[model samples]
Target: MSGETTNETWEEIVVRVLKANEVSLVTYVPDNVLSRLIRLIEADPFFTVVAPAREEEAVAIVTGAYMAGKRGIALMQTSGFATIVNALASLACPFQIPLLLMISERGTLGEFQQGQAIVCRTMRPVLQSLGIEHFAIQERAHVEFVVDGMVRQAFATQAPAALILSPLLTKRAA
Candidate 1:
């Protein structure tokens, strides 16, 4: 109770925080690691979930939704995050859209795919280069804090923010 989500799963905490923040639009490119989170968001009537063909398309969808006076979040895998750089740089950043990205971290220790690892390495650098605020949620206790704080910051400042869901947090590291 009172912002303490110690008993809930990370996905549940994410959905709770998102709802609490009034993020009504959920835009994402389907990702296996994020399936549970997406499903939870979809089941909730408060959210308008949209799956676009590509990660960049998801970003665009969120941007358009924000323009129309609705808050949105984009969910994707780390590799998919690599595909949205142009859209984020062009449409989201320059236009002052508060694009909230929830990326399922891939590539790194215990990872099997070389491409995922390659892209994972580049994600943080790209975010930093673009001056997009980002944070990784690796602990259950930290989930609500990071997600909620990032969401608040992005919308308050009209800037982009990312919440990277680490394999450790999702318990699907591979």
Candidate 2:
């Protein structure tokens, strides 16, 4: 299924794409922006959801899971993403682990928090500097395609890929 139905939410589409890609392990650091996605992933028996104390830990967990012959993903908000830069650069990238990351975009579109806004601007540049493949999903219509393709390419190339969930898609913009 392409998950093109109007009734299917972006969160549901994400779960479906993850399952279709055989990504059975879900690691995350709790965040309000990603709560719905995490809840859906946890409720599904197909996924083994792990909530770590920090985003960096989630990255390490997914990397370890991948080493054990499992496909995994790390979900977190933009602020949490700031904590994982070192882990992503030193561990995931150098080790060639296809650590999947799903980040909820914040600090944009009338954001109230100055800290979030600052980090948001640096996110894309950091990803580019590290040569990590990243895509932003601003609309539900393109979620499945971008997610599936990123998953496939990440594993195939043995490199990490990021999926940024834009507020426009989540309907949380300002």
> lDDT of all predictions, in order shown?
0.88, 0.90
User: In model 1, which residue pairs have backbone atoms overlapping below 3 Å?
Assistant: none
Model 2 Cα RMSD, 1 decimal: 1.7
The pairs that clash in candidate 2 are none
lDDT of 2 by residue, 1-174 (tens): 644457888888888889999999999887787888888988899999888788888999999999999999999989888888899889999999999999999999879999999999989998999999999999888888899999999999999999998888886532
* TM-score, per-candidate, Cα-based: 0.95, 0.95
| Residue 158 alpha-carbon offset, candidate 1, angstroms | 0.5
Q: In lDDT terms, which candidate is top?
A: 2
Model 1 scores what on Cα lDDT? 0.88
